[model samples]
Target: MNRRQFLCTTGAFAGWSGGVACQARAEAYTVDRALVLVDLNGGNDGLNTVIPIGDPLYRALRPTLAVPHDQVLPLDERTGLHPSLGPLLGAWRGQELAIVQGVGHDAGNRSHFRSRQIWDTASDTHEYRDDTWLAHASLPAASFVASCTDAARSIAQHEAAVVRIALHGFDTHENQALRHAALLGQLAQGLMMLRARLIASDDWHRTLVMTNSDFGRSARENAVGGTDHGAAAAHFLMGGNVRGGLWGAAPRLNALDTGDGLPVSLDFRQLHATACAHLGVAPPSSVERFAPLPLLRV
Candidate 1:
Protein backbone atom coordinates (compact mmCIF):
# COMPACT_ATOMS: atom_id res chain seq x y z
CA MET A 1 0.00 0.00 0.00
CA ASN A 2 1.02 3.59 -0.49
CA ARG A 3 2.06 5.83 2.41
CA ARG A 4 -1.28 7.63 2.68
CA GLN A 5 -3.19 4.37 2.51
CA PHE A 6 -0.89 2.82 5.12
CA LEU A 7 -1.43 5.80 7.42
CA CYS A 8 -5.22 5.65 7.00
CA THR A 9 -5.26 1.95 7.75
CA THR A 10 -2.95 2.06 10.79
CA GLY A 11 -2.77 5.60 12.11
CA ALA A 12 -5.33 7.95 13.66
CA PHE A 13 -7.83 7.66 10.84
CA ALA A 14 -7.85 3.90 11.18
CA GLY A 15 -11.58 3.52 11.88
CA TRP A 16 -13.10 5.85 9.30
CA SER A 17 -14.26 4.38 6.01
CA GLY A 18 -12.99 7.15 3.75
CA GLY A 19 -12.28 10.85 3.53
CA VAL A 20 -15.37 11.48 1.38
CA ALA A 21 -17.59 9.80 3.94
CA CYS A 22 -16.00 11.82 6.73
CA GLN A 23 -16.39 15.14 4.91
CA ALA A 24 -19.98 14.28 4.01
CA ARG A 25 -20.80 13.58 7.64
CA ALA A 26 -18.80 16.53 8.95
CA GLU A 27 -21.78 18.89 8.88
CA ALA A 28 -23.72 16.58 11.18
CA TYR A 29 -21.12 16.96 13.96
CA THR A 30 -20.41 19.74 16.39
CA VAL A 31 -17.02 19.28 17.95
CA ASP A 32 -16.08 21.10 21.18
CA ARG A 33 -12.75 19.36 21.84
CA ALA A 34 -9.92 17.72 19.94
CA LEU A 35 -7.31 14.95 20.43
CA VAL A 36 -3.96 14.60 18.72
CA LEU A 37 -2.12 11.30 19.01
CA VAL A 38 1.58 10.87 18.27
CA ASP A 39 2.43 7.24 17.68
CA LEU A 40 6.08 6.36 18.19
CA ASN A 41 6.13 3.26 15.98
CA GLY A 42 9.17 1.47 17.37
CA GLY A 43 9.50 0.60 21.02
CA ASN A 44 10.83 3.59 22.94
CA ASP A 45 13.43 3.14 25.64
CA GLY A 46 11.47 4.21 28.69
CA LEU A 47 14.28 3.58 31.17
CA ASN A 48 16.46 6.10 29.37
CA THR A 49 13.65 8.54 28.60
CA VAL A 50 12.47 8.73 32.19
CA ILE A 51 15.53 8.04 34.31
CA PRO A 52 15.17 6.54 37.79
CA ILE A 53 18.14 8.20 39.40
CA GLY A 54 17.33 6.98 42.89
CA ASP A 55 17.49 3.35 41.82
CA PRO A 56 20.99 1.94 41.91
CA LEU A 57 19.84 -0.93 39.75
CA TYR A 58 19.35 1.45 36.83
CA ARG A 59 22.98 2.48 36.78
CA ALA A 60 24.14 -1.09 37.20
CA LEU A 61 21.82 -2.49 34.54
CA ARG A 62 22.51 0.18 31.95
CA PRO A 63 26.05 1.17 32.67
CA THR A 64 26.91 2.22 29.14
CA LEU A 65 23.48 3.52 28.18
CA ALA A 66 22.46 5.31 31.38
CA VAL A 67 22.10 9.06 31.39
CA PRO A 68 24.17 10.48 34.22
CA HIS A 69 22.23 11.90 37.18
CA ASP A 70 23.78 15.33 36.77
CA GLN A 71 22.81 15.48 33.09
CA VAL A 72 19.18 14.45 33.57
CA LEU A 73 16.54 17.15 33.79
CA PRO A 74 15.17 16.87 37.31
CA LEU A 75 11.46 16.20 37.48
CA ASP A 76 11.67 15.19 41.14
CA GLU A 77 14.27 14.03 43.63
CA ARG A 78 14.02 10.39 42.63
CA THR A 79 13.26 10.60 38.91
CA GLY A 80 14.38 12.81 36.06
CA LEU A 81 14.03 13.07 32.27
CA HIS A 82 16.48 12.51 29.44
CA PRO A 83 18.61 15.46 28.47
CA SER A 84 17.20 15.53 24.95
CA LEU A 85 13.72 16.15 26.41
CA GLY A 86 14.88 19.50 27.79
CA PRO A 87 12.41 21.24 25.48
CA LEU A 88 9.49 19.78 27.45
CA LEU A 89 10.82 20.92 30.81
CA GLY A 90 8.69 24.07 30.59
CA ALA A 91 5.56 22.03 30.02
CA TRP A 92 6.36 19.82 33.00
CA ARG A 93 7.09 22.81 35.16
CA GLY A 94 3.85 24.50 34.12
CA GLN A 95 1.92 21.32 34.97
CA GLU A 96 0.56 21.04 31.43
CA LEU A 97 2.34 17.77 30.81
CA ALA A 98 1.85 14.50 32.70
CA ILE A 99 4.12 11.47 32.60
CA VAL A 100 2.29 8.13 32.79
CA GLN A 101 4.72 5.44 33.80
CA GLY A 102 4.94 1.65 33.50
CA VAL A 103 2.33 1.42 30.73
CA GLY A 104 1.91 -1.89 28.93
CA HIS A 105 -0.63 -4.63 28.48
CA ASP A 106 -0.43 -8.15 29.93
CA ALA A 107 1.84 -10.77 28.32
CA GLY A 108 4.19 -8.43 26.58
CA ASN A 109 5.15 -9.57 23.08
CA ARG A 110 8.69 -8.72 21.97
CA SER A 111 8.32 -8.75 18.21
CA HIS A 112 7.87 -5.27 16.74
CA PHE A 113 5.05 -6.20 14.37
CA ARG A 114 3.08 -8.31 16.83
CA SER A 115 3.54 -5.97 19.76
CA ARG A 116 2.57 -2.92 17.71
CA GLN A 117 -0.46 -4.69 16.31
CA ILE A 118 -1.53 -5.60 19.83
CA TRP A 119 -1.11 -2.01 20.97
CA ASP A 120 -2.90 -0.60 17.93
CA THR A 121 -5.84 -2.98 18.33
CA ALA A 122 -5.79 -2.71 22.12
CA SER A 123 -6.26 -6.44 22.44
CA ASP A 124 -5.08 -8.86 25.10
CA THR A 125 -1.99 -10.88 24.25
CA HIS A 126 -3.92 -14.15 24.04
CA GLU A 127 -6.76 -12.58 22.01
CA TYR A 128 -6.63 -11.36 18.42
CA ARG A 129 -8.67 -8.39 17.22
CA ASP A 130 -9.63 -7.71 13.64
CA ASP A 131 -10.41 -4.09 14.25
CA THR A 132 -8.53 -1.42 16.15
CA TRP A 133 -9.89 0.03 19.39
CA LEU A 134 -9.74 3.51 17.87
CA ALA A 135 -11.93 2.23 15.05
CA HIS A 136 -14.45 0.81 17.50
CA ALA A 137 -14.66 3.94 19.59
CA SER A 138 -16.90 6.69 18.22
CA LEU A 139 -14.59 9.37 16.91
CA PRO A 140 -14.93 12.54 14.93
CA ALA A 141 -14.14 12.40 11.22
CA ALA A 142 -10.63 11.19 10.44
CA SER A 143 -8.19 13.54 8.73
CA PHE A 144 -4.85 12.27 7.49
CA VAL A 145 -2.12 14.16 9.29
CA ALA A 146 1.57 13.37 8.96
CA SER A 147 3.85 14.65 11.72
CA CYS A 148 6.90 15.39 9.59
CA THR A 149 4.88 17.21 6.98
CA ASP A 150 2.20 19.81 7.73
CA ALA A 151 0.78 18.38 10.93
CA ALA A 152 0.51 21.62 12.87
CA ARG A 153 -0.97 23.37 9.87
CA SER A 154 -3.49 20.59 9.38
CA ILE A 155 -4.61 20.86 12.98
CA ALA A 156 -4.91 24.63 12.68
CA GLN A 157 -6.70 24.46 9.32
CA HIS A 158 -9.08 21.57 9.89
CA GLU A 159 -11.91 20.99 12.35
CA ALA A 160 -11.32 17.29 12.80
CA ALA A 161 -11.62 16.40 16.50
CA VAL A 162 -9.20 13.47 16.24
CA VAL A 163 -5.86 13.82 14.47
CA ARG A 164 -3.16 11.15 14.48
CA ILE A 165 0.45 11.42 13.39
CA ALA A 166 2.62 8.33 13.04
CA LEU A 167 6.39 8.55 13.47
CA HIS A 168 8.96 5.78 13.23
CA GLY A 169 12.75 5.35 13.81
CA PHE A 170 12.80 4.44 17.53
CA ASP A 171 13.99 0.85 16.88
CA THR A 172 17.57 1.85 17.73
CA HIS A 173 19.27 -1.54 17.46
CA GLU A 174 22.61 0.26 16.93
CA ASN A 175 24.04 3.67 17.83
CA GLN A 176 21.01 4.26 20.00
CA ALA A 177 22.27 7.39 21.70
CA LEU A 178 22.69 9.36 18.47
CA ARG A 179 19.60 8.01 16.72
CA HIS A 180 17.30 8.26 19.74
CA ALA A 181 18.50 11.75 20.56
CA ALA A 182 17.71 12.94 17.04
CA LEU A 183 14.27 11.34 17.14
CA LEU A 184 13.50 12.77 20.57
CA GLY A 185 14.64 16.17 19.40
CA GLN A 186 12.24 15.96 16.49
CA LEU A 187 9.42 14.95 18.83
CA ALA A 188 10.13 17.73 21.29
CA GLN A 189 10.43 20.34 18.56
CA GLY A 190 7.32 19.15 16.72
CA LEU A 191 5.18 19.22 19.86
CA MET A 192 6.45 22.67 20.77
CA MET A 193 5.61 23.93 17.31
CA LEU A 194 2.15 22.33 17.44
CA ARG A 195 1.52 23.91 20.82
CA ALA A 196 2.56 27.30 19.54
CA ARG A 197 0.28 27.02 16.54
CA LEU A 198 -2.65 25.87 18.69
CA ILE A 199 -2.15 28.73 21.10
CA ALA A 200 -1.98 31.16 18.20
CA SER A 201 -5.22 29.79 16.81
CA ASP A 202 -6.88 29.74 20.24
CA ASP A 203 -7.15 25.94 20.17
CA TRP A 204 -4.51 25.09 22.76
CA HIS A 205 -6.92 24.82 25.67
CA ARG A 206 -9.37 22.67 23.70
CA THR A 207 -6.80 20.28 22.29
CA LEU A 208 -5.27 17.25 24.00
CA VAL A 209 -2.00 15.77 22.72
CA MET A 210 -0.75 12.36 23.82
CA THR A 211 2.09 9.98 22.89
CA ASN A 212 2.17 6.18 22.59
CA SER A 213 4.62 3.49 21.53
CA ASP A 214 4.63 -0.18 20.60
CA PHE A 215 6.37 -1.11 23.87
CA GLY A 216 9.61 -0.27 25.64
CA ARG A 217 13.26 -1.26 25.45
CA SER A 218 14.84 -3.71 27.89
CA ALA A 219 16.10 -2.32 31.19
CA ARG A 220 19.55 -3.70 30.48
CA GLU A 221 21.43 -2.62 27.41
CA ASN A 222 22.47 -5.28 24.95
CA ALA A 223 26.06 -6.22 24.03
CA VAL A 224 25.93 -3.74 21.12
CA GLY A 225 25.29 -0.71 23.35
CA GLY A 226 21.61 -0.75 22.36
CA THR A 227 18.50 -2.35 23.81
CA ASP A 228 16.18 -5.13 22.82
CA HIS A 229 12.39 -5.21 22.92
CA GLY A 230 10.90 -5.07 26.41
CA ALA A 231 7.71 -3.79 28.00
CA ALA A 232 6.01 -1.04 30.03
CA ALA A 233 7.12 2.30 28.63
CA ALA A 234 6.26 5.80 29.72
CA HIS A 235 3.56 7.88 27.98
CA PHE A 236 2.72 11.54 28.03
CA LEU A 237 -0.59 13.44 28.13
CA MET A 238 -0.65 17.18 27.71
CA GLY A 239 -3.52 19.65 27.67
CA GLY A 240 -5.01 22.50 29.59
CA ASN A 241 -7.66 20.31 31.24
CA VAL A 242 -5.29 17.48 32.08
CA ARG A 243 -4.39 17.27 35.78
CA GLY A 244 -0.71 16.75 35.10
CA GLY A 245 2.24 15.91 37.34
CA LEU A 246 3.47 12.31 37.12
CA TRP A 247 0.26 10.27 36.98
CA GLY A 248 1.47 6.66 37.54
CA ALA A 249 4.02 4.80 39.62
CA ALA A 250 7.57 4.81 38.30
CA PRO A 251 8.90 1.49 37.03
CA ARG A 252 11.08 -0.29 39.60
CA LEU A 253 14.44 -1.16 38.06
CA ASN A 254 14.97 -4.16 40.32
CA ALA A 255 11.49 -5.63 39.82
CA LEU A 256 11.68 -6.91 36.29
CA ASP A 257 9.53 -9.60 34.74
CA THR A 258 10.97 -12.89 33.49
CA GLY A 259 11.90 -11.19 30.22
CA ASP A 260 14.12 -8.80 32.16
CA GLY A 261 11.70 -6.00 31.34
CA LEU A 262 9.79 -3.67 33.55
CA PRO A 263 6.53 -5.13 34.81
CA VAL A 264 3.34 -3.62 33.53
CA SER A 265 2.11 -1.25 36.19
CA LEU A 266 -0.63 0.61 34.31
CA ASP A 267 -2.57 -1.12 31.58
CA PHE A 268 -2.61 0.80 28.28
CA ARG A 269 -6.37 0.31 27.97
CA GLN A 270 -6.95 2.44 31.04
CA LEU A 271 -5.28 5.29 29.17
CA HIS A 272 -7.45 4.57 26.14
CA ALA A 273 -10.56 4.65 28.31
CA THR A 274 -9.38 7.95 29.72
CA ALA A 275 -8.94 9.31 26.19
CA CYS A 276 -12.42 8.08 25.20
CA ALA A 277 -13.90 9.69 28.28
CA HIS A 278 -12.15 12.95 27.45
CA LEU A 279 -13.46 12.85 23.89
CA GLY A 280 -16.98 12.05 25.09
CA VAL A 281 -16.89 8.68 23.39
CA ALA A 282 -17.56 5.32 25.02
CA PRO A 283 -14.97 2.62 24.61
CA PRO A 284 -16.38 -0.54 23.01
CA SER A 285 -17.78 -2.98 25.55
CA SER A 286 -15.44 -5.67 24.25
CA VAL A 287 -12.46 -3.58 25.41
CA GLU A 288 -13.96 -1.78 28.39
CA ARG A 289 -12.56 -4.28 30.89
CA PHE A 290 -10.39 -1.55 32.37
CA ALA A 291 -11.85 1.60 33.86
CA PRO A 292 -11.04 5.04 32.50
CA LEU A 293 -7.93 6.47 34.10
CA PRO A 294 -8.53 9.68 36.04
CA LEU A 295 -5.91 11.50 34.04
CA LEU A 296 -8.00 14.26 32.55
CA ARG A 297 -11.06 16.29 33.59
CA VAL A 298 -14.42 14.94 32.59
Candidate 2:
Protein backbone atom coordinates (compact mmCIF):
# COMPACT_ATOMS: atom_id res chain seq x y z
CA MET A 1 0.00 0.00 0.00
CA ASN A 2 1.18 3.52 -0.74
CA ARG A 3 2.10 5.72 2.22
CA ARG A 4 -0.95 7.98 1.88
CA GLN A 5 -3.43 5.08 1.71
CA PHE A 6 -1.54 3.23 4.42
CA LEU A 7 -1.68 6.19 6.77
CA CYS A 8 -5.40 6.57 6.02
CA THR A 9 -6.11 2.92 6.79
CA THR A 10 -5.72 3.50 10.50
CA GLY A 11 -2.36 3.42 12.24
CA ALA A 12 -2.90 -0.15 13.30
CA PHE A 13 -3.03 -1.28 9.69
CA ALA A 14 -0.30 1.04 8.56
CA GLY A 15 2.82 -1.14 8.36
CA TRP A 16 4.83 2.06 8.79
CA SER A 17 3.46 2.89 12.24
CA GLY A 18 5.89 2.83 15.17
CA GLY A 19 4.23 -0.06 17.00
CA VAL A 20 3.74 -1.95 13.77
CA ALA A 21 7.33 -1.32 12.79
CA CYS A 22 8.70 -2.76 16.02
CA GLN A 23 6.43 -5.79 15.87
CA ALA A 24 7.25 -6.31 12.25
CA ARG A 25 10.94 -5.96 12.95
CA ALA A 26 10.72 -8.66 15.58
CA GLU A 27 8.60 -10.87 13.37
CA ALA A 28 10.64 -10.30 10.27
CA TYR A 29 13.77 -11.48 12.01
CA THR A 30 14.26 -15.19 11.31
CA VAL A 31 15.25 -16.55 14.71
CA ASP A 32 13.14 -19.38 16.05
CA ARG A 33 14.21 -19.35 19.68
CA ALA A 34 12.65 -21.56 22.35
CA LEU A 35 13.33 -21.77 26.10
CA VAL A 36 13.57 -24.45 28.79
CA LEU A 37 13.42 -23.10 32.31
CA VAL A 38 14.99 -25.31 34.99
CA ASP A 39 14.00 -23.83 38.32
CA LEU A 40 16.64 -25.15 40.70
CA ASN A 41 14.81 -25.80 43.98
CA GLY A 42 17.70 -25.06 46.29
CA GLY A 43 19.68 -21.84 46.16
CA ASN A 44 22.81 -23.61 44.88
CA ASP A 45 25.28 -21.09 46.26
CA GLY A 46 26.24 -18.70 43.46
CA LEU A 47 29.56 -17.74 45.04
CA ASN A 48 30.74 -21.28 44.58
CA THR A 49 29.60 -21.74 40.98
CA VAL A 50 30.21 -18.19 39.68
CA ILE A 51 33.00 -17.81 42.17
CA PRO A 52 34.27 -14.43 43.40
CA ILE A 53 37.79 -15.43 44.23
CA GLY A 54 38.89 -11.79 43.95
CA ASP A 55 36.91 -10.80 47.00
CA PRO A 56 38.45 -11.73 50.33
CA LEU A 57 35.02 -11.38 51.96
CA TYR A 58 33.91 -14.51 50.12
CA ARG A 59 36.74 -16.50 51.61
CA ALA A 60 35.68 -15.59 55.12
CA LEU A 61 32.02 -16.49 54.68
CA ARG A 62 32.15 -20.26 54.27
CA PRO A 63 35.55 -21.60 55.13
CA THR A 64 34.27 -25.15 55.31
CA LEU A 65 31.96 -25.25 52.26
CA ALA A 66 34.01 -22.82 50.19
CA VAL A 67 35.27 -24.08 46.84
CA PRO A 68 38.99 -23.36 46.89
CA HIS A 69 40.36 -21.06 44.14
CA ASP A 70 42.48 -23.83 42.63
CA GLN A 71 39.54 -26.21 42.39
CA VAL A 72 37.26 -23.77 40.56
CA LEU A 73 36.55 -24.10 36.85
CA PRO A 74 37.67 -20.67 35.74
CA LEU A 75 35.52 -18.52 33.47
CA ASP A 76 37.69 -15.44 33.98
CA GLU A 77 39.34 -13.47 36.75
CA ARG A 78 35.96 -12.70 38.34
CA THR A 79 34.12 -16.03 38.13
CA GLY A 80 34.49 -19.80 38.06
CA LEU A 81 32.30 -22.90 38.28
CA HIS A 82 31.63 -25.58 40.85
CA PRO A 83 33.25 -28.92 40.13
CA SER A 84 29.81 -30.54 40.28
CA LEU A 85 28.64 -28.41 37.32
CA GLY A 86 31.07 -29.96 34.85
CA PRO A 87 28.53 -30.66 32.11
CA LEU A 88 27.27 -27.06 32.17
CA LEU A 89 30.80 -25.71 32.11
CA GLY A 90 31.33 -27.60 28.90
CA ALA A 91 28.39 -25.65 27.46
CA TRP A 92 30.06 -22.46 28.70
CA ARG A 93 33.32 -23.27 26.98
CA GLY A 94 31.42 -23.88 23.76
CA GLN A 95 29.77 -20.43 24.04
CA GLU A 96 26.38 -21.97 24.85
CA LEU A 97 26.02 -20.50 28.32
CA ALA A 98 24.89 -17.10 29.65
CA ILE A 99 25.32 -17.07 33.41
CA VAL A 100 23.37 -14.02 34.63
CA GLN A 101 24.42 -13.92 38.25
CA GLY A 102 23.07 -12.38 41.53
CA VAL A 103 19.46 -13.28 40.78
CA GLY A 104 16.88 -12.62 43.48
CA HIS A 105 13.90 -10.34 44.11
CA ASP A 106 13.94 -7.38 46.46
CA ALA A 107 13.36 -7.86 50.21
CA GLY A 108 13.75 -11.54 49.54
CA ASN A 109 11.83 -14.07 51.55
CA ARG A 110 14.04 -16.90 52.72
CA SER A 111 11.13 -19.33 52.95
CA HIS A 112 11.31 -22.15 50.46
CA PHE A 113 7.63 -22.31 49.55
CA ARG A 114 7.15 -18.56 49.71
CA SER A 115 10.14 -17.58 47.62
CA ARG A 116 9.38 -20.28 45.13
CA GLN A 117 5.82 -19.04 44.75
CA ILE A 118 7.15 -15.53 44.17
CA TRP A 119 9.43 -16.83 41.45
CA ASP A 120 6.51 -18.73 39.96
CA THR A 121 4.01 -15.92 40.32
CA ALA A 122 6.48 -13.06 39.79
CA SER A 123 5.09 -11.28 42.82
CA ASP A 124 6.60 -9.08 45.51
CA THR A 125 7.79 -10.04 48.99
CA HIS A 126 4.93 -8.43 50.95
CA GLU A 127 2.27 -10.03 48.79
CA TYR A 128 1.51 -13.19 50.73
CA ARG A 129 -0.65 -15.89 49.20
CA ASP A 130 -1.36 -19.57 49.66
CA ASP A 131 1.12 -21.71 47.75
CA THR A 132 -1.58 -24.36 47.35
CA TRP A 133 -3.91 -21.89 45.65
CA LEU A 134 -4.19 -22.22 41.88
CA ALA A 135 -5.18 -19.74 39.16
CA HIS A 136 -7.61 -22.10 37.50
CA ALA A 137 -9.88 -19.16 36.85
CA SER A 138 -7.41 -17.73 34.38
CA LEU A 139 -6.21 -20.84 32.57
CA PRO A 140 -7.78 -22.83 29.75
CA ALA A 141 -8.82 -26.09 31.34
CA ALA A 142 -7.70 -28.02 28.27
CA SER A 143 -4.22 -26.57 28.64
CA PHE A 144 -3.88 -27.88 32.18
CA VAL A 145 -1.45 -30.72 32.78
CA ALA A 146 -3.66 -33.12 34.73
CA SER A 147 -0.70 -35.20 35.90
CA CYS A 148 1.08 -32.23 37.47
CA THR A 149 -1.69 -29.90 38.58
CA ASP A 150 0.25 -28.00 41.24
CA ALA A 151 3.27 -27.63 39.04
CA ALA A 152 1.25 -26.46 36.05
CA ARG A 153 -1.06 -24.39 38.21
CA SER A 154 1.64 -21.96 39.31
CA ILE A 155 2.56 -20.67 35.82
CA ALA A 156 -0.49 -21.49 33.67
CA GLN A 157 -2.15 -18.23 34.59
CA HIS A 158 0.50 -16.31 32.73
CA GLU A 159 1.07 -16.31 28.98
CA ALA A 160 3.27 -19.28 28.18
CA ALA A 161 5.31 -19.31 24.96
CA VAL A 162 3.15 -22.12 23.47
CA VAL A 163 4.05 -25.00 25.89
CA ARG A 164 4.41 -25.67 29.61
CA ILE A 165 5.48 -28.50 31.94
CA ALA A 166 4.79 -28.92 35.61
CA LEU A 167 7.63 -30.20 37.78
CA HIS A 168 7.02 -31.77 41.24
CA GLY A 169 10.08 -33.68 42.46
CA PHE A 170 12.36 -30.72 43.17
CA ASP A 171 11.62 -30.65 46.89
CA THR A 172 12.92 -34.11 47.64
CA HIS A 173 16.18 -34.03 49.60
CA GLU A 174 17.23 -37.66 49.93
CA ASN A 175 19.18 -37.47 46.67
CA GLN A 176 19.77 -33.73 46.50
CA ALA A 177 22.01 -33.38 43.48
CA LEU A 178 20.30 -36.24 41.72
CA ARG A 179 16.88 -34.68 42.15
CA HIS A 180 18.10 -31.28 40.94
CA ALA A 181 19.73 -32.87 37.92
CA ALA A 182 16.52 -34.74 37.15
CA LEU A 183 14.62 -31.46 37.32
CA LEU A 184 17.10 -29.91 34.90
CA GLY A 185 16.59 -32.79 32.50
CA GLN A 186 12.85 -32.29 32.65
CA LEU A 187 13.25 -28.58 31.94
CA ALA A 188 15.34 -29.36 28.92
CA GLN A 189 12.64 -31.72 27.75
CA GLY A 190 9.98 -29.08 28.29
CA LEU A 191 11.84 -26.62 26.07
CA MET A 192 12.13 -29.28 23.44
CA MET A 193 8.37 -29.57 23.54
CA LEU A 194 8.05 -25.80 23.21
CA ARG A 195 10.48 -25.92 20.35
CA ALA A 196 8.34 -28.49 18.58
CA ARG A 197 5.33 -26.32 19.12
CA LEU A 198 7.05 -23.25 17.71
CA ILE A 199 8.23 -25.14 14.67
CA ALA A 200 4.85 -26.73 14.12
CA SER A 201 3.25 -23.32 14.33
CA ASP A 202 5.53 -22.31 11.45
CA ASP A 203 6.52 -19.17 13.34
CA TRP A 204 10.11 -19.94 12.44
CA HIS A 205 10.89 -16.23 12.81
CA ARG A 206 11.35 -16.18 16.58
CA THR A 207 13.85 -16.97 19.35
CA LEU A 208 13.73 -18.97 22.58
CA VAL A 209 15.36 -18.64 25.99
CA MET A 210 15.06 -21.69 28.21
CA THR A 211 15.52 -20.98 31.88
CA ASN A 212 14.82 -22.44 35.38
CA SER A 213 16.11 -21.95 38.94
CA ASP A 214 15.88 -23.37 42.48
CA PHE A 215 15.46 -21.65 45.80
CA GLY A 216 18.20 -22.22 48.36
CA ARG A 217 15.64 -23.30 50.91
CA SER A 218 17.30 -26.48 51.96
CA ALA A 219 17.52 -27.08 55.70
CA ARG A 220 21.26 -27.12 56.40
CA GLU A 221 22.53 -30.43 57.75
CA ASN A 222 25.41 -32.89 57.49
CA ALA A 223 27.33 -34.19 54.46
CA VAL A 224 24.53 -36.50 53.31
CA GLY A 225 21.52 -34.79 54.85
CA GLY A 226 19.48 -31.65 54.28
CA THR A 227 20.35 -28.11 53.12
CA ASP A 228 19.00 -24.88 54.56
CA HIS A 229 17.95 -21.56 53.11
CA GLY A 230 20.82 -19.69 51.50
CA ALA A 231 21.35 -17.58 48.42
CA ALA A 232 22.98 -17.66 44.95
CA ALA A 233 21.70 -20.44 42.73
CA ALA A 234 22.20 -21.38 39.09
CA HIS A 235 19.88 -21.20 36.06
CA PHE A 236 20.71 -22.83 32.73
CA LEU A 237 19.85 -21.63 29.21
CA MET A 238 20.57 -23.54 26.04
CA GLY A 239 19.66 -23.59 22.36
CA GLY A 240 21.31 -21.66 19.51
CA ASN A 241 19.70 -18.33 20.37
CA VAL A 242 21.53 -17.63 23.64
CA ARG A 243 24.55 -15.27 23.66
CA GLY A 244 26.13 -17.99 25.73
CA GLY A 245 29.82 -18.32 26.46
CA LEU A 246 29.45 -17.47 30.15
CA TRP A 247 27.98 -13.94 30.14
CA GLY A 248 27.51 -12.19 33.51
CA ALA A 249 29.35 -9.80 35.85
CA ALA A 250 29.84 -11.61 39.17
CA PRO A 251 32.82 -12.51 41.37
CA ARG A 252 34.85 -15.70 41.44
CA LEU A 253 35.20 -18.59 43.87
CA ASN A 254 37.11 -18.27 47.18
CA ALA A 255 35.91 -14.64 47.01
CA LEU A 256 32.33 -15.41 48.02
CA ASP A 257 30.54 -13.52 50.74
CA THR A 258 27.45 -15.22 52.10
CA GLY A 259 26.63 -12.09 54.09
CA ASP A 260 22.92 -12.89 54.33
CA GLY A 261 23.70 -16.38 53.26
CA LEU A 262 23.20 -15.36 49.59
CA PRO A 263 25.09 -13.81 46.71
CA VAL A 264 24.85 -10.02 46.79
CA SER A 265 25.84 -9.37 43.19
CA LEU A 266 22.98 -10.46 40.96
CA ASP A 267 19.36 -9.44 41.24
CA PHE A 268 16.92 -12.09 40.12
CA ARG A 269 14.91 -9.47 38.21
CA GLN A 270 17.87 -8.60 36.01
CA LEU A 271 17.98 -12.23 34.97
CA HIS A 272 14.24 -11.91 34.48
CA ALA A 273 14.92 -8.95 32.22
CA THR A 274 17.47 -10.98 30.29
CA ALA A 275 14.93 -13.76 29.95
CA CYS A 276 12.13 -11.41 28.93
CA ALA A 277 14.36 -9.88 26.30
CA HIS A 278 15.23 -13.35 25.09
CA LEU A 279 11.57 -14.45 24.98
CA GLY A 280 10.75 -11.48 22.76
CA VAL A 281 8.19 -10.12 25.21
CA ALA A 282 8.10 -6.73 26.86
CA PRO A 283 9.57 -6.54 30.34
CA PRO A 284 7.01 -6.31 33.14
CA SER A 285 6.62 -3.10 35.11
CA SER A 286 7.79 -4.79 38.26
CA VAL A 287 9.20 -8.14 39.14
CA GLU A 288 5.72 -9.07 40.42
CA ARG A 289 4.15 -8.73 37.03
CA PHE A 290 4.91 -11.62 34.71
CA ALA A 291 7.13 -10.15 32.04
CA PRO A 292 7.40 -11.88 28.68
CA LEU A 293 11.09 -12.43 27.94
CA PRO A 294 12.58 -11.85 24.49
CA LEU A 295 14.81 -14.93 24.60
CA LEU A 296 13.17 -16.91 21.85
CA ARG A 297 14.86 -18.04 18.62
CA VAL A 298 12.67 -17.57 15.60
* Top candidate (lDDT): 1
TM-scores for the candidates: 0.87, 0.55
Q: Where does candidate 1 clash, by residue pair?
A: none
For model 1, the superposed segments whose C-alpha errors exceed 4 Å read 1-12, 15-25, 136-149
Candidate 2 lDDT, 84-189, residue by residue in tens: 5555654466555566655566656666767777766556678764431111111122221332232222222222232223345554434454554455444444
Kindly give the number of clashing pairs for every candidate: 0, 76
Global lDDT scores for all candidate models: 0.74, 0.45
Error of 2 at 168 (Å): 7.3
Off by over 4 Å in 2: 1-31, 56-59, 68-70, 128-210, 214-227, 232-234, 245-259, 263-266, 283-298
Best by the TM-score measure = 1
Tens-digit per-residue lDDT, 1-298, candidate 1: 2323322332445565333233322233345566777878788988888888888999899878888778898888888988888988877877889899999988899988888778778888987887777631122232222352344454455435566676678887777887887777777777777777777877777778888898998898888989888889899888767877887888888789877789999998888877777766667665578897776755
Give candidate 2's TM-score.
Answer: 0.55
